[model samples]
Target: MPVQRGYRQACGVARGLDIVGERWSLLVVRELLLGPKRFTDLQQALPGASPNALSDRLRELADAGVLRRRQLPPPGNTRVYELTTWGHDLEPIVVALGTWALAAPPTPEQIFVSADSAMLTIRTYYVPTPDQPAQTLQIDLRDHGPAGTFTAHLTSSGAAVAHEPPEQPDAVLVTTTEALLAAFGDDDVPGLVAADAVITGDADVVRRLLSSVHVPPATDPR
Candidate 1:
């Protein structure tokens, strides 16, 4: 497939957009932020994108030095895509954009948020409280329907998500997407527990973590 034409502008923003402004390009970057993923995995994550469109976007990103395709070694010799060092630099930009977009009024229709996206939100919006001690809190966030597990490491510095579980997690919180959304919106611990969200190990750690999330104030719908 032929690559799309650039904006032909000298501005830095325009040049940056020329590389990643294409449809589904940034979404591809978002998916690879956590780790590498096979093409099929990318397809699954981005269900709205057609196969051809996805292929083109990946090609464009790779050409622009945003991502690279490599073959996994030995046991898993399948080809996977991962963000380059420069590509990883886009994390803060994407997080900021997501945070800003959160201020927009909600739509009538439900929005589907992937597990990675949810974890990214937690990482981005987390704020450390002066009262809370600076300790590492590890929590396992599980997506029941998709059956994927993500480990969140919370510290005074910030929060980070990993594909594998922490060797020694301070606590574990297992909940579905719906329950997570509710808890994130209201910081309702009891409500989540009542709804079957399981919390094991030190409950205080989970409490502090939840309390630290900086939810944006409600915006006027009008």
Candidate 2:
């Protein structure tokens, strides 16, 4: 589909931009990277976006074949937007973009970070190590507006996160986004546990997992 006010360039990057260069276009795709989300979920994730603006972006993305809306079956009937097969292909691109952004300046204090974005942090900064044994972890993030449960798989090569709980995880970390970020950025598990964070399983798994995250420093160096 043709985008409005297109760059009208012949290059591949320009062409791709023409489709997703709008303000919140790529962010919309980012929210759906893990799985489908209801309109309310998107709103919670992107508080800066006006309802009308978000609607317009969603429509445009649907037209561009990046996402599709579907209704859930039965008792939990609700509409949700999910990335199409072609849309899911944007995951690596989004990850690369996020990784690229790590070199940029630190964000201002109290900036909002959606749960999906928090999960993406895991994917973006994942470091594989032979000493880091494979394990399944259940992550429960609360008080982040529409709390999220995720299952993370740490492998020899990489880590994978899904928006679902595991039947039997090797460890479970329950914490708020702030504490989780603190742990991720500083690997401060004991501090987190002393605060609002809770751990039900192997603490070493949680420690190793948090230590494995290589996020940019929260404070500016300059």
Candidate 3:
């Protein structure tokens, strides 16, 4: 369906597309997933969209009962957009699409996460470390849709990937695909702090691992 789809279509697909079929409409859902956001925050997340388009889409979505405008605490009179109970229903559809795409040929995470300009690398790995030499870390996440693939090399210099359980990764961090990009790309682990991405096998060793596997400063936005 093209961008102009209206609510009058007969088929369910047509009717459904009527809500999120616009160029940047579904992405509006994406920004909201992170949390309720102000209009400016949405604009920053959606760089290509115009303020007018965003306002129109937001208005339409609210009218359709998908999103709702909420007010923040007193003294801070800012308007934020949040998904209604009905809007939360779309999560499964998004996740199913992710699973469906995984069935196709696996190329790279970049292809799946191409929506955002930020190039990210997400990977799941089993790494061996000194503290917990037998542990393994399996990570999965992408900030963008379709998800991306990346290699989490053992950052222990010449130590190489080991087979021991606890001595390996110490902890496994699971998060959305962009966990790495935010940690390593934007160099902002604080962003995921709210989600607590670390999965600990050996708490002590995982602490060290966190410092070791970090992306270089070059990609650090903060």
- Per TM-score, the best of the predicted structures is 2
How do these models rank on TM-score, best leading? 2, 1, 3
- The alpha-carbon lDDT assigned to residue 39 of candidate 2 equals 95
Error of 2 at 152 (Å): 1.2
Cα-based lDDT for every prediction = 0.76, 0.85, 0.53
After superposing candidate 2, which stretches have Cα over 4 Å from the reference? 1-3, 185-187, 216-222
Location of the lowest summed lDDT over 10 successive residues in candidate 2:
213-222
Q: Give the TM-score of candidate 3.
A: 0.49
How many clashing pairs does model 3 include? 25
Candidate 3 lDDT by residue in tens digits, 1-222: 224647776898878898778777777775564347789767766767899999989988888887899999889799999988888787566545544554455445433343222221112212334543333443433343222222233443312321122224445555554454445423244455556664445443334434444332322222
Estimate, for each residue in 123-183, the C-alpha lDDT of model 1 and write its tens digit.
7778856554545444444553342577777766777778777777878888776577667
Runs off by more than 4 Å, candidate 1: 1-5, 130-147, 185-187, 218-222
